[model samples]
Target: MEIIAPGDKFFHDIPEKIINDTRYMSYFKDCIGVIDGTHVDARIPVEEQAAYIGRYHSLTQNVIAACDFNMCFTFVSPGWEGSAHAVRIFKHAVMDPKYNFPAPPPVDAGYPLQRGYLRPYLGTRYHIPDFRRGHINAE
Candidate 1:
């Protein structure tokens, strides 16, 4: 996991292109990467059915991954129960000293914006579907 899961060094070391990109420069000035949760289909024993059924109503494992602008996975936390909320998984992860997730930056209005992982401002549209639908094609 260390080979791909970046250490603290990566937080301060982002590419020039990503830093200069107008799309990210302002809001994401200190952000080194992005984090997202995903559900991976899995087939588990009947006894574990209740534990693995995800929001989509299927057997799965919930995974949270952090990646750089280049789309390379820098950190991947898998094996959480499918029903687990992404926030819960993240909270548990950072609390574990062994995992050593990056420390968050200074508090922002009582809400500590995660240090290296830049969460979108509340109410901003950041859904994947929004990006999938091209602006040129949207009515």
Candidate 2:
């Protein structure tokens, strides 16, 4: 609660910084970042284990974040879980009037669904990847 500065509280220029930086994972262009679930040890009471025990072994929180090729975190949802999804946290962080990133084209649009872009299948929409790759005919 006390570590984050007011400006760094949520999404910001971090995503754009990752998109432009070429020093890290060069495979991506216009890609904002990637995230994965990891487990960590906890000291909480046994009653709390049910909520924390993640996919494989022990207690954990589902962390969803976007990091640049340089391993710098651009956007991060620190404490999240199976009850919620990564896309939901990212969307929540950005939609707050503070971030002001361009809202994605409405979900009803045709290109995303047809190309299998950010559908429920590809996982959450937080993947700031350069999805434009190999997308010449998508228009």
Q: How many clashing residue pairs appear in each of the predictions shown?
A: 0, 5
- Kindly report which residue pairs in candidate 2 clash with one another: 24-69, 25-69, 31-129, 31-130, 32-128
Each candidate structure's TM-score, on Cα atoms with residue i matched to residue i, is 0.72, 0.43
Query: By TM-score, how accurate is candidate 1?
Result: 0.72
List of clashing residue pairs for candidate 1? none
What TM-score would candidate 2 get against the native?
Answer: 0.43
Question: 78-101, model 1: which lDDT tens digit per residue?
Answer: 888899888888877777978866
What are the Cα lDDT values of the candidates?
Answer: 0.71, 0.46
Best by TM-score: 1
What digit string (tens of lDDT, one per residue) describes model 2 on residues 1-139?
3232223333244454545667743543333334443334555567665766665556667665554445765555566553345456555655586644333323332222332114333433433344544343432
